[model samples]
Target: MSVLPLIFTSGWASGINAYAVVLLFGVFGATGLTDEVPEALQRPDVLIAAGVLFLCEAVADKIPYVDSLWDSVHTVIRPVAGAVVGALLAGQSGSVPELAAGAVGGSTALVSHLVKAGTRMAINTSPEPFSNVIMSTTEDLGVAGIITFAIFHPVGAAVVAGTLLVLGTVTALFLVSRIRAFLRRRAQRRAERRAGQAVGPPV
Candidate 1:
């Protein structure tokens, strides 16, 4: 029940598209991100698997241009995560209804990922060196979280993930528009102040 809330809240708040992106570049052959940890915590194989996945994500991120390359390769990665989500849902469920759930999961993830990647690309176009790195690291953790949820709690995870995706994308658009308006108003105020100075006390 507790995990259910995490799954639900994070699912919606995290954005489906971003969750998709995380899976796109990170899920393939990477076991730890989605692998279930044995409750016992005594399994050597589980430990090894966890270590390897973390190492790959960490190492890949460190190589200056590797992140870009990874992104390029993941063009297909987003869809694949969706497919996996679909398949998982279908397997756990029965008939057309179950399959539909998978499709929804996959599609939600795809949309969420698209928005997130587009936003990140726009932000990175600026010349700030550290901004991209900081963004990438944060996103990586997000990806890990999504995967963990997908693997461990499919139904609850799907509901939460889907909700988060919708909420995030919508909220992001609202925030962006608000910020632009604020900036425009600020700019106008500055212009008015400048004109007042030039007018020289209305004389």
Candidate 2:
């Protein structure tokens, strides 16, 4: 089977939660749940590192500005992870197939990562904190679902991932104006508060 399916699926998952994808692959490979898992991923050090990072992400992703910062930091990490996963799935090194797989994975991951990061930035403009938690949780669940399914049915998972990528990108971009409005409102509120404080209490 061509590695394209896994490449796309991993790419999408990496955009949402690269550490979780890595941890899943490491755990699956370590436990012998699947043969397609990579040997390096099965290493204890890799598993530990991915696990720790995943934990940090799980917490940071639920905070507003913190989540944006986290996404910015991972802009590179996620795409790199996608490429690595693709190369492993290709089952070769330095060959044309592996290189192509890496390119596909990296490109796909970049698109989804941009969508995820942009959406999160937009969401952060709101004053409510719960939305961040809700969205982050949903994304984490989505990544888990897709990666788990990809292990057995890569083609189906790829289709789902592709659909999601397109829809999410469109939706986030559509909300840009609204996010800007929210930011304006929040800024106005802050300015009003500052002005009130500056004037001192009326006698």
Poorest stretch of ten by lDDT in candidate 1: 1-10
Per-model TM-score, in order, reads: 0.48, 0.86
Which lDDT tens digits does candidate 2 get at residues 1-203?
76688788998898889899989988877887888777888889999999999999999999999999999998999999898888887763333388788888888888999999999988887889999999999998999989989989989999999999999989888788688787799999999999999999999
- lDDT accuracy of residue 84 in candidate 2: 86
lDDT of each: 0.49, 0.88
Candidate 2: the clashing residue pairs are none
Q: How accurate is candidate 2 locally (lDDT)?
A: 0.88
How much is the lDDT of residue 63 in candidate 2?
Answer: 96
TM value for model 1: 0.48
